[model samples]
Target: MMMVGKPVYGIAKSRSAFAQAMKSQAPQQTLDDLFAAVARQVPEFGGMFLGDNEETLQVYLSVVSPTKVVAVQKAIVAVFGTSVIPKGGVKALQGQYGFLQLKDWYDRMTGPILRVSGVTFTDIAEGRNHLAIGIGKPEVESRVIEQLQKLAIPRESVVIEVSGPIETLTHTVRMPNSMSPWPYLRAGGYILTRLLCNQTGVGISQATLGFNIIGPSLGAGFVTASHATAAWWKLDTIAGFPPADFYQASGYYPPHLVGRETVDPHGFTGGACPTGLICRYSDSAFVRYNSNVKFGVGHIARTTGITTSVTSPILTIDHGGSPSGEFLIVAAPSVPYLTGLTLNKVGHYTGWTQGKIQMTNANFSQIPSAYIQVGCPGGLADPTMPPAGATLLSQYVVGDPTNDVVHSGDSGSPVFRSLKGLALRRAELYGIVWARFAGTYKQFIFSPIGGVPFQPTGVKTDLPPFRYCDASASPPC
Candidate 1:
């Protein structure tokens, strides 16, 4: 990691001024400059990771407050037991570069904005090294812009940032990913798919197969959400699991690392792990089979060379979508659980995906209750594509009306890509889910996503206009 500091040059100065002025005044800041700057600063974004040149890592960030970053850090600590990412901005870092190195900040989720640049600087409390103010160069702006265009996230959803520059900054105003002060979901934790389920008797056969995701825990011993309390893997490795959890709730839940359990304490079985340790969620429930023993952690099955969770991602089923309704279970792909074939849930956001919906002639199920129809945000991937008549709702799935896909109790579950490979955030949503469908599908679903608990902007356009309290009363707080 090299740190270079110099006076801003002519081209750099001009680009910096233009970017700064635009960022300062413009409601939506473009990141073309920030990404390019990082690339010019480091080669990781420039395909250096791929043995390619001139390609700087193209990093795009959706605006987040320092405070929220800290809260998410806490959630990461509380939910996902693993230091999965470095101490500072691991998720953010992954978005910037193609991959992240975990060994550096194993206990925390923090790091520099860009790593490929090999530019390192220690924090200075009173004296220096805190270049949080601005980018010091302009030549880097082009690379940032180029990468931004290449990464292709929504312009309205990004706030461009670059390192090594003082004024080479861009602010891209975006729809808030989290609405509430608390984060919705914490990175990789055991996810649950919470739907109508009668887990007791004859109902188990008629149970509605909900969606979900689950992560391994180091304390919970085995898994939850399964028919049994312990969610032990049926087969080793992710090749068997589906997603993260068996029960999927929508709210904020982090990942947990299960302790390794080596079989023979007296060298009876063989190999290294004789008895594995135990992993648990913040709830203090033991999760996986072995805790201390690290598996053959390898890069995800993408060409990106990113590592993946060696254990199977779990899924949860929502009997009612609550701590009571939720149960954690392993989604071993090879084990076989889901009844229907997973469809391609397409959307524009890299961390966002949608489910293939078949419009029915029955009635607008969501309408007057949970209606997601035409005119929704990111409505259609291809309005002119094959599925012309069917409409894509604003939300990826039907969630609680006040909040959607899920609400207060519905945090921490994976908005899964059961069929897709575990690469690229696996093209999944990585935040809190706080809304549900309030209308019927026969009509259309309109989504109004806010920071965390954002409500529908105008769902009652059909009903009489009425003025009411916008938020829950906090006892006249």
Candidate 2:
């Protein structure tokens, strides 16, 4: 959770003042901490939202049984002075739940059932009351439903989705690196920016570097689809071959594929883990920035040759690169996961596109072996699944029925909150783009940065630069 300053008692001395602060949106972290504190104090905390006037922070507690709603409000008032209207009783609290708490309960209850063959992924709904499970094979739906019934999940709150067959989503045929012919050379090294191409020369298809991130232990590292590196790692380790390089356009000859290193998949011998060199999760990989190679950070491109920087918490409204000159400020991790929000991604094939988050806490098991072996390498699987604990979420953008929200080369693009008008310095990194539904518009599967398990072998720090967006959005300063 994002750390918040001490609540100001004087400012909220009056309920009207408190409402005014909320109206300003008062920074997402402030609101998040308030809700988190209340939920933590009361296990039965259900859900919270702004009242019709948009000033009152309305809270609801579980009405499974009678609740002291007024007493709870008084207690909260004594501490924060924030205006709240507590609603109780079964009727009022129907379908309400504490998202984090309920998700934890579901995870605890369904561990064994998750390992079933057809169970691809599972996640608590954004609303906290609903649960969704991705079923790979339709035939196993009955058994899954029976298992859930035994576990006591309400039938109406559960949604079973079909995510297609058991095949791995890895696209193995490598494409030509798509750098411009006349690449810019800076400071005696090839300086590449957005749209400069990259790849592992093996059978894997070429992909574009999405953006770069900075952390304490490392320099800027390029980010991309995890499958690109995973596919190469298998070949690199078993066949003793080298991975591909990042490239700028070479004027005379074919663009030189500069020698790039494989950080995650870090090689199959060591399944991808969070290292200063490479952090892999969400079907995405981070490649250490080699000063010798000289690649710049930030700057994403659209199909129309326009570009924007990722350094700020912002997103351009137009997808085709025709600059709308309008940018949507990003929200912090305090408000990390939400459905029905617009999201954007940049990739080697599909330049840029937008979509909405269809679900949260999505579960997936039928993934490439690389993810299964994460943080363990040659050892037995880690037992923890790729997205099981808060590390991932899924989204589907219904485009014009022609363009995909994301494509194979687009993996590793950051999925961020857009158009909320929240204030911030740079684009908030929400989750890493990984896989997509085959033959459908469900183009991206994302892993939240917060829930990733850092292996003891790599850089021991949380994901860098954006670590604040991790588990609770509050990282040690």
Candidate 3:
């Protein structure tokens, strides 16, 4: 079944019922309106998520009063009707702080908390209705708690756990079969850029193409990880490497031109990024295709016989398979909360893999020395290093306990959810994969597609508008 909306609770009896519930609006829009209504009715709305059984919507509030509980119940019934509500109705729980307040604390404390040695990531756990911090060293937990206490942040409002360092997912291998020879470009296809690696000693760097995007006035282009271009900064000392050129198969002699690097903001000094931190809304970059190049709008490549080993030399990409093998991108939703939603991605190295979202609105940072050691070149005193801090904001953390959900060379891979019940091989585009945590193959991170910075504010997926038609509608409808 295809579950839609944030905290998508309960199950639809049929496809038509689901469509009617959503009406003409996208699932996300409908849910957003409902949540907004609840927030308006209840001033102390903390957050919401699905119950453990996935049957009831669990709403949390700073103060769980009878009047507020009734308001939340009314909001749910008004938006989704009584049938959608569970037998127990909408359950309200008492929380230590409101969601907005926690978010404010999250934003204010991310830099300071990350500055603590061994801290790996920080996020707001909506289900728990509090802030969650992950540290690489268990011994550092007390120090982190002390920092929070110094800020007057309630000890009961936060949870700390031991974790591993998060690292970029750029692969360096000599896989001749990873290249795409097809005339039309598609998402998940292999893309290589040798400009940055020539001096770093990391040979033949490769990444997966995300998806096709177009601006009303900017024509067409494709998106990938900005780091994949190896041009993170404007002052690249490497001669003839200012703007990295991307190739379809290989950058060797008779290179197949895919596109030219266009929009990639190195780092912003202030705003959502904090003054001293090298921060980016998304770890993505735009690549404008050549004039004569042809591309698929929302098509994503499918492969079979994927290798299980993370260090494997090659992935068995099946390009000549039937149309059923391809996944059609039907919709793009800004998933607000992703605690337990199942999502999947296809990459050049890992092929097709699926995992559940563990956290959202998460922040992760890498020290300048660690980043530089892994192919990037910027010393602590260099312009690339942020004097204050370096962190990524609003990232999705996904994991699969038993397997490696993502690997090197998987950066820029399209992350999406399967909507097979609605239409065969149909899916919704969610975000793009960028990095994974070290010492564990179980987790990786992605940035939402809507976060990609493009000019004119009209840039979006090239796919046609998605709509649901009645059974009696006209053939074209």
Candidate 4:
């Protein structure tokens, strides 16, 4: 929960920082001097807030110096979403504070043109002006009028507009003292980026946009990796560019778990969503993550049978594999209530990462397609939706078995069904990933749709079978 570049502080600590900022040089220092003093309080990342002090008072006045007006305006805008009236800032002049009439308040907020909000220019002359301000996160119009009312000038000169309960607040509420709240800060969310990446089948997230060029047609998708977890930028650069990159987007859905909560006594976990099935209904695109993608050339290490058990929780890729990593998935079986199973969702590199398993059992009948989708997290190869107990090999045209074993960027990855190895069926060598290639290896890569070229020669690194199947999650043989 740590903010990338912000200090952790309680209200009291923050107040201390502000007070410390006030102790510098002289009370009547220049605006630049004021900013510098407040900056010292931050001590790190330029402590982006400020407080009221004699120097702050002086600097506040100096803001009228024209050079500092815009600076003040910018800061004020950040906190309340707009600047104060021309009559002056908090230091300019103070006489009265109250609820001004709505029409006058509205006028001040909207201006004669009735356009921009949360900004004002008040030059009160006489009488009492009662203006009631709105509550938190007020409308732009209300924000501006609220500042003017805080001046507390006489009632005759001002009136105000309140959107809801008409809470009677003093014109001048405590401003950020510094710009803690600004419009620019709440611009993006991590989950959205992650979803966009996965849904589009691309390999990049939205958090990394600053580092990557997000032109149109680049699409929105990303591939995941345990290798380059935190240091993903290197991979990003290597993949060229992934549009709309975002970072450290973390989220999880417990309802999606299997056997534990939603499952029945017989071992059937009711229907659930597949982790990696991108629908054509979505306007998604593809992406590339360089090192982030491990050319998962490995296998499962343990033995498994289709059975329901609570004595022990299933170990995911954590099961014993080999001296090197290989593909060994937890095969699932068809049951009335349970449609899917879960895995450890982590990497345990043990075997040779790139060896073939000539399926000694070779039986995929009782396996449910639901489990297969889970194996590929957010991916499902239903192609034309076959009936129950149908083996996937029956669904596709097999190409080269030797070449099908591994490919580039497929490292530390698992090709599975039911979120495990048993359901995983390596694509026929040179088979299509269902994605098309717009460009060629010889030329620049075009995005959106492109062909998945066959595993080129030489790029292949020979290794033994690393797969280890969990005897626990596999179907009853």
Candidate 5:
């Protein structure tokens, strides 16, 4: 890599004012300008982030081989201009099609059985590059290694660590509802009452709205865990009635449409076990916002208690000085897991809970094939097990065993990371609560947005546009 000594730009008067003015621009906008310019210069960009100082921007360039680093670096400098490319800022990492090679390899080796839980790359004292993997169990790990060997992955090229148990986290919907009392506040993560069940009882369960989605079909609506809305997927009329004066997180009850039930054209049954790793092929559904009803963004609410073992405090969304434009939380792509990153979630049952990401790109075998249901009658394609080595599986696994951070109505609650600290910070959407380990109290599972299938039927909504933060923050943050 060629080192470009720091090139100084002409200093302007009132430096603080200039910096403040720049900060006033939406963070997303700043990211766009930098990345767009960088892409025009070097097309093979993978990802970028704020370095330790939160000012030095590190731009990742995916290279086919180590020898191409200099050429790519030159191209970047030629396009970005000398001063724009921070001194010693460009990282020319070798990977496939602009992604880390091991990242691609982990996706391939795990097949559909294991979601690639987490990935990390580092060079230690000996100066040898080490790739760490958060794999599941020995049974699954052995199978993954066999696949790696077929790809010629020498044992030395990687290190594997057991993540959470290899077994699938229990799907919350598949279990019995706790029938917890509904809260007064309506928000993204809460229990929506009176789902008519085919069984002998009215379905009383919990769910969360992952985010608001807008497309051509209707001006706006929200998406939630597919299984949470599974009962309504194939039917139009809700057989049971909700409590009078009842409203949902969206501030409206189910519409009276005769034949319109929640649909999941991409439910678990679709094929090869559609789960959260890929949103398009996920266990999620969309509920069109009923224009006739009034709604408000009440903000996600939860209890401040750590778990049932401790006393709880009522918790609600903490508004901060930062003005979160348009969306409070935006989608993030799946990547290797970082051990100690703190994650926050607000749900109808748990209220407010903070935990660490135990695994990423995790896989679960417990998806009962019977639960699969595509949106259309005949279904998109005959459901089948996805072939091994398919490149599209990524999701999250909350490995903590004691917190019970989520519960019955928690499915679909937004999973996010606060920008600064937990008190009051802008959050980057990571995934949505989907499942958990049956007997475990704290373990939770989520679907990563990056793996969400792109381009579904119905009026199309463009992938949320990328906005730049002044600090070089990018999407999939």
Candidate 6:
């Protein structure tokens, strides 16, 4: 979890005032220390969040015993001092189970629950202090409940909702003309690859380039969705198959060779995964760009004219290499994973959009055969039984009821939150858009940058020059 200052609730009349208020609050370390003290003192501590009023620190407890509540209150007082404990006092609420317990139950019950037909996703709802299971069909709710009962999981500790199917957001055809012909490549720009699937013939695939990164040994590269590459299913199967080449703007044309896939770990069973479940931390792939291509670190393409058709133009509003039109990534701080925190994303197809985080640490189910056929065709044989599917862990789910937050060709888009007080046109990097729920325009999912496997030592930015120090080098260069 990221360190945060005092919670800001409701609408802020002035960004400067909001920043000043955050600056005046007690250091984030104090809250962290208080949380640690409470966790050590109260074993039933469920979780913590900012109260609706913004001043109170709302703590949840499984049992909510008088002694535990008093201990938590005392800890808060000791940390913040009785006289200056914000405006609203700390409050302890009754919860069904502790956060850790709910996480454990989530790991244990995901396979069984997903085995039931029509199940879509599962999440550890830290804010609500319960486990949530999503199903596509309402009739399967009883079966899901029965599965939970069989595992001895309390019904009250879990919530089942109809969420429909989850599908990847990679588009098979060329996207609208939002491509940037700028001298440098940047985040939120377009990337393309050609695929010749055995099942589906030749086609061009498009997805958003996530961000620019650099490592001590890997040099400079960018990240994107693994499934958007050509012959992705053969990554782990075929030997000596050529690495897929990526293009920008135009396909099979000059000045289009940008990079090639380098690091993409295939899914596997066992080793930290629950029994019978295939596991992977991210649906991301790292691409090492060519030396000739200039990469603009922290720069996100400013786009406009959003449309759902292939013929319509989605124009890149910024031109002539001006920084004013782009969103500058000031920091890549860890997210607090709090529900209702507003986040924004810039995709090649969707342009820029905003939504609130609905769930954190969400796990989405993928049928084993379908997953392998699409991204790992020549791997292990298909399983004949249920509960033997793939589960993607540690994902953020965002939704906006009034608008479509994501769409086809938006995979690998940069997901972030604006930092209004820090600077104009500045934001913090959070995650990368990967998939969206089918039949719904509101819900989409992203993989947190911190959890992305093989991520760079640090995210590169334009303002501050990023330096990579190798611990193994002589004199720790």
lDDT of each: 0.19, 0.40, 0.59, 0.20, 0.39, 0.58
In model 2, where do residues sit more than 4 Å from their true spots?
1-44, 47-93, 96-101, 149-157, 165-204, 230-235, 238-240, 244-259, 265-281, 289-294, 303-334, 366-404, 418-426, 449-477
Candidate 5 residues 366-442, lDDT tens each?
23323333332323211222223222223455544455566555676666665554345445555567665443546
Q: Per-prediction count of colliding residue pairs?
A: 188, 22, 1, 107, 34, 2
Relative to the true structure, candidate 5 reaches a TM of 0.51
| 1 against 6, candidate with superior lDDT | 6
RMSD of each: 25.4, 10.7, 7.0, 29.0, 11.2, 8.8
Candidate 6's C-alpha runs over 4 A off are 1-40, 49-58, 62-94, 115-117, 172-184, 191-201, 231-242, 304-315, 319-322, 368-388, 454-477
For model 6, how does the per-residue alpha-carbon lDDT over 1-477 read when each residue is reduced to its tens digit? 111111121112233332232222221221222334545666687666554523666678878777888877765444334532336776787877765576567768977886677787776665677778888778989999889989998899887877766777764113323444544543455555444332234445667887766655556777777666543322422433345667665344435667777666555565444566666556676777888887666766665434333344354555433354566665543234445567788777667777777776666775422332333344422111122466665567877656777777788888877766533466666677888877666767887654453221232211112211112212110
> Which structure among the candidates has the greatest TM-score?
3
How does each model score on TM-score?
A: 0.18, 0.58, 0.74, 0.17, 0.51, 0.72
Candidate 4, superposed: residue stretches over 4 Å from native? 1-286, 291-315, 323-477
Ten residues in a row with the worst lDDT in model 3?
Answer: 1-10
What tens-digit string does per-residue lDDT give for candidate 2 at 251-364? 112454333544433321122221111223234445564564443333333233222321221222234322221122222332323333345655444444565445544444
lDDT of 1 by residue, 184-291 (tens): 221122222211111111110100111221222122222121111111211111222122222211222212222221110001111211112111101111123333
Quote model 4's TM-score. 0.17
lDDT of 6 at 282: 61
Question: Could you give candidate 4's per-residue lDDT for residues 1-477 as a string of tens digits?
Answer: 000000010111222332222211111121222223332332111111111211221112211345434454444333222211222332321223211222234334322212223211111111121222212123554544445466443334443332222110000001112323221111000111232222245332211110111122222123222112211212222223222232222222222111100100011111110112111100111233333322221122221221122122222222233322223323221100000111111111111112111111000111111211111233322111222221111001111122222122112222222222334321111011111011111100000010111011222111111112233322211
How do the candidates rank by lDDT, highest first? Answer: 3, 6, 2, 5, 4, 1
Q: Worst lDDT window (10 residues) for model 2?
A: 1-10
Q: List the residue pairs that clash in candidate 3.
A: 171-409
Residue 169 in candidate 2, Cα distance off native in Å? 5.7
Error of 3 at 390 (Å): 2.9
